[model samples]
Target: MTDLTPPAKRPANPRFSSGPCAKIPGFSLDHLADAPLGRSHRAAIGKAKLKEAIDLTREILGVPADYRIGIVPASDTGAVEMAMWSLLGARPVEMLAWESFGEGWVTDVVKQLKLDAKVQVAPYGQIVDFTTVDFDRDVVFTWNGTTSGCRLPTGDAIPASRAGLTICDATSAAFAMDLPWDKLDVTTFSWQKVLGGEGAHGMLILSPRAVERLETYTPAWPLPKIFRLTSKGKLIEGIFVGETINTPSMLAVEDYLVALKWAKSVGGLQGLVNRATANAKVVWEFCAANPWIANLAETADIASTTSVCLKFTDPRITDGETFAKAVAKRLEKAGVAFDVGAYRDAPPGLRIWCGSTVETSDVQALMPWIAHAFDAEIASLAAAA
Candidate 1:
């Protein structure tokens, strides 16, 4: 029942997981030869390397001159929690969720912190209505819902003069999409995403308003040492300048520096966006021609460009979960692709990474393999019938 006639070509690289995505096309361990291995992070050389990573990040991301950026512990989650615990209790909160990660943040606000929060949530594959949110109440949400394959269509929902702060989880969105920095008060992302760097640390970007919030308000709950951004009623300016609270992985830092350098070499943020947009077009065109396969996202405008998700619409597939898993397993077994399965919390479908680090050519090459796998699954269903 399998399709023995394989495609003429295969994806050059088959490492498309949602996170820790494909590395730069020419990436090699040889590039990290200069990493300060075994050197004390507090040493002058170690400090200089860390500062270099920070400077390049700011320059490439085009962060505002006044905003503060810091390399924090954990991944994006730590950055988000630090902002939440340090600054949230000062005002009433609005928790909006459309996917697993968003739901986790909602749980933290309403149940754990027990704040006076209004929860607005939507089912997977759909977005919540931004109109229902009260801007006067601090709003927390995921800029890109990675699991459900949806993203914020625009920042128009947030007013510039709004009284409350906007905290966003942009781990999967940052480099691949345009973030309205003026509209966001606190934004968090990790290197494991679009940059194709290691996931040893997270990046936290704070607007002037976010800094003011930290200076003016402190949560009643206890703050862990790692989450502390202020000391004795004043902001710790050193952390914002590469003085990390804990020892960081110099190896990971070197890897991230390599990624940043590559990003600049490719024409900065717009170039990265173009790569992701072009890669996602391949999935869009495939869905258009193949009636059986369709995007899981409900709306085209809000669809994810990085983690492209698709569901099967054919009548022959009796069990969506079983059939989708079979298709992904077949692709993985053939070595044409790997980890293309839908996220555990998402709908039964296929999830492909189309971030900047993933080559459009690789995505184009993988299409035939996908079709072969789908056709093979269809044949299996017919045989079973």
Candidate 2:
């Protein structure tokens, strides 16, 4: 096979960063030419754009009438923290953790909430034993672990008749996977993931049960005005409307609108799923042919269709940390991909973002370059040995 190095000065292609994935493939500055750049977010026109974004997201995701969708503070992390702070004190909580993002919530529950809690955790590449968890307690988990590239097969594993709330950090899984909306009490994600939009905001969806919990139960910790979901113990109606607790960037709101429009034009949620599935398959096929490479995730069914985790099989670099760093650097130097590094909190393995915004053609181009990088790195290691 031929080495896949580009001629010197070639521009980046197949960029595989996990957060801000490729921007709508052919996206250009022309798309933003007519955007209102200098308008106040509180203006009638800006509010109208925000309202449209909320409606489009609701329609695209098939969100139920009983739920409340709000554009909230920060990105995915902020939305999750708002939910945790605003909604937790009512029930005994169980936090499920398998990767960095999941573990972040666990830290918030134990260290920040100081709640009476239990943690169910597993190392990178492994999943928590679902059978061992009690559904009667409030549960927090990531539908897809972007860092580890592992995901729960489905929300079906969650007990149907559980009395406590189910809160999910679905930033990476939102548009790319099938979410059992009936089972989720609270869900949070960001536009920067599957939609490939500007960050700085998060989307928080709350089921009726969650709203009821907020109305009846109050958290002990002091909540910022922005995190409060209720006005004098009554759910806020304006949040679901065009009203926001704090000002939001109009530009980001416009980007989200553009992304939602693209998502709908491509056939809505199912189309997004198809794009992610196709991109991930390209990586899977490459892994199957490469003897020295394998997915860090164990099973095909459990592996993420959004972020594909991979690692080298070289025995000499048995330390996952060493191998992951070497391979990532080689790929970066070759210009095959960028920010294709392992999560600092996750076990060492490359995490490639394969969200819907990333193109399958880009992934196809990336695979051969990956093989070339691996061969070059391995040879260098042997030479040093």
Candidate 3:
């Protein structure tokens, strides 16, 4: 583990990382002490808290009354995996991959499950041609690819009469965007993204059709205890009602409950979206003023309001990888932000999470430091030149 030693001087402004982003303003560990500790997850108190989180998720999203929501394992990754393993084997599947996370789903199809699947892929800065996906086949996509900062505007591209289902990994888009539930059959996200809670729990929401599929079609492979979606060919009712198949972190559950309460107080889902949009606009305006900085995803309309990605335009720093790493290192050293580097699989850029939990003023304060970080690296490169 890295040293937790206090720095000689602390950053005047708080840092903003993409995932495990900033927490709700004024949040503290003191609140966590009151969380129902040492309580059995199956106990009435634990169940009541977990149930509250589930209920709040539905209320904030305005999910259809017929849909079922449950807490799952491994955060967003686990929620998506659960849907894939439990619901995909019986159908002809169409997988759309635009960035690293979407590509992960493709890997799950080809390598892990080894299913016969048709894959449509797009480069990092662009979205897949929505018209190309055969709605007749089971469709899988990421609502917002966290790495690329690109997303599909809506599922209107999905044909209305198609017999297939749409499964979406909406890890980064959940509460920040209007998810068209009529078109999505399975939706997955995590508390750590828009919710700003600790990780290790995934939220899975299934449409009526998804539930039907789980009850009717069984995967040929033997599922591990955690991946099983049904019991004796019947969808387990209690799991969706705060009963988990395996043990989960009660502390994490409590944190999620607190997040849900905060979400409700801030005008629920719409408020969350507003906060992210407002924060992203600050970064976008900064990019407009600084000629050296531009968005990796071209088109402001398509830009992500949650993860604002920035690319440097300096030809002198042609190797975006080197420039981005150095800038991120400098920012970390300054204690202005940590983990601001582009994802390894992505082209070099700064990816900042302008999520609901982040304060717009903090983003405003941090922008100058981002410029300083870039300037320091560029100056060093020039000295070497």
Kindly list the per-residue Cα lDDT of model 3 for residues 45-93, writing each as its tens digit.
8888888888888999999989999998888999999999888878799
Distance (Å) between predicted and true CA of 117, model 2?
Answer: 0.6
Candidate 2 per-residue lDDT over residues 1-385, each given as its tens digit: 4454543433346578888766776788677665677987678887788889889988999999888999898899989999999888788999998898899899888998898788988887878888888889999999899899999888777877889899999999998898999989999999888888888899999998899999998888899988888988998888887688888887778778888888998889999999999989988888898877788888888889888898777676756687678778877876778998888877677888999988777788777667666677666777788
lDDT of 3: 0.85
Per-model C-alpha lDDT, please?
A: 0.90, 0.84, 0.85
Q: Candidate 3: which pairs clash?
A: none
**Compared with the true structure, what per-residue lDDT tens digits does model 1 show for residues 141-203?**
998888888988889989998999999999999989999999999999998999988986999
Candidate 3 lowest-lDDT run of ten? 1-10
Weakest lDDT window of 10 consecutive positions for candidate 1: 1-10
TM-score to native of every candidate shown: 0.98, 0.95, 0.95
Candidate RMSDs in Å, in order, are 1.3, 2.1, 4.4
Candidate 3: residue 277 lDDT (0-100): 92
Model 3, position 381: C-alpha lDDT score: 81
